[model samples]
Target: MSGLLALLDDVAAIAKVAAASVDDIAAAAAKAGTKAAGVVIDDAAVTPKYVHGFQADRELPIIWRIALGSLKNKLVVLLPGLLALDAFAPWAITPLLMLGGAYLCFEGAEKLVHMFAPHADHEIEADFDTRDPARLEEEKVAGAIKTDFILSAEIMTIALATIESPSFWMQAITLAVVGTFITVAVYGAVALIVKMDDLGLHMAATGHTSGSRALGRGLVRAMPRLMAVLSTVGTAAMLWVGGNIVIHGLDVTQLWAWPYKTIKYVATELANALPAAQGLVQWLVTAALDGVFGLILGVILIPIATRVVGPAIAAIWPGKST
Candidate 1:
């Protein structure tokens, strides 16, 4: 009986340790996931377009396909590459992170330009217009997956940077959690967003009560506006997150310090000025400054990306680029 009690105590201790590890993993995953919020939001916002114009019955399947592709991109392709970088070239992570930040800025800036000074990408439009339905669907899915790879790379790298774990296994597990969670959350949201109108329509048509029908009508009417809001939010988030990343990266590398220092100073002053709302004031000011810096950097990069980078990629990859 004494021996049995001792064994039970040992098992309980093991259970306690296992529970602690699970808690640690969850905490790390949550922190890392938040660091990649901009990419995740933009991902959710961008994916719906790939399913647009598809038959109603095909929408969920298409989203499922893209979601699977996104998962594969994150896990199969990016995860190992990132782990290798962490293991062998740890010093390169910051520079690569900043490069990802610059790409985010470029994307955000391009979207801003398109919103205000829209110009058709005749090649893209022509390609879509000329392709048969099946071919177009395939191409759209392919393009979306390609886009997801870049975004996934950014997400994974950001997650990696934020993870505090030094153990390789812990880092691996945390990244896997972040990747899987973000993929599900983003694509699941996309699925709901795309089908919302249909759901609204069905509710409106079949609801037994006037209030339910009215709510359904409201939902249908609200979708387009919701999408517009989502796009705007995603763009702003990209710029804010991207600029913040670059500023921090620059500070880390001792390449440029003033931008971050200046922002901190301003935020501190604002927080001091509004002590009652110190945290909010500081965060809003910091985010605003970061966003402005991002906008400026993005605008500057726009010409370089379009005039030089796009042309170079196009030369090498032909229709696969730009």
Candidate 2:
């Protein structure tokens, strides 16, 4: 039985190695996912508005559909593309990242403008309001999925850049995990946010106890305000992430280093000045500068986008673009 024991020992050794590899994968995935937090936050925040006015019965199903679409967007379309790009043309990633950053800044700034500034789109927002449940649901789902695709692309690209795997298979698996986890987390939260009102209403109507009814009423009242806060936080996150990416990209390329360097230096000086609360000061300073940079870049791009890229896209796509 010596040979049998040797064989068992060998098997045990192989299992140990396999376990190590799995642990490595998990560790890398967690770190990479953390690095992509801003895009992920923006994604989670943006998804809920799509199901805002849908009928209660249809909300979960709609989120499910969009979640599936998001999975397909990240895993099927983007994962392979990222791997291929890494394999063939690694240099394109920084530029593509900057492009995605610009889009995020534009989207975030547009939302800000829509909120505080009355404009053509805001007027249309009230004018073309649909009351039909079915039509409105379809339009909202379609729009949400389209927006999710852009955010998902950003998430995937950021994850791909952070992954330092030895093989494409490893990168693909990690990305798939990040994509699936993020999708479930975002949509699951969306579903809860959308349904908490109905749940609260039902509790108020049916609960036998006064305390339960009071809690339910509070929940119903709190949800809308919570959503508004979440949206504002999401916008800030987008600007912070986008501006940080652009500035970091510029630094990486050695193109325009002065502004970012100045920001970094000021942040460091502030941190040093306040030693007890150094970390908080540093973070706040960095975030503020990043957001301001994002706002300026977005403002500059808005004009160019409206006058130049918008026209070129319409010319190329003919009927598809507006």
Best by lDDT: 1
Clashing pairs in 1: none
* 86 Cα displacement, candidate 1 (Å): 1.8
Q: Estimated TM-score per prediction?
A: 0.83, 0.85
- TM-score for predicted model 2 compared with the true structure: 0.85
Judged by TM-score, which candidate is best?
A: 2
Q: How many residue pairs clash in each candidate?
A: 0, 0
**Model 1 ranges with Cα > 4 A deviation:** 1-23, 34-55, 120-147
**Which 10-residue window of candidate 2 scores lowest in summed lDDT?**
120-129
Model 2 score (lDDT): 0.80
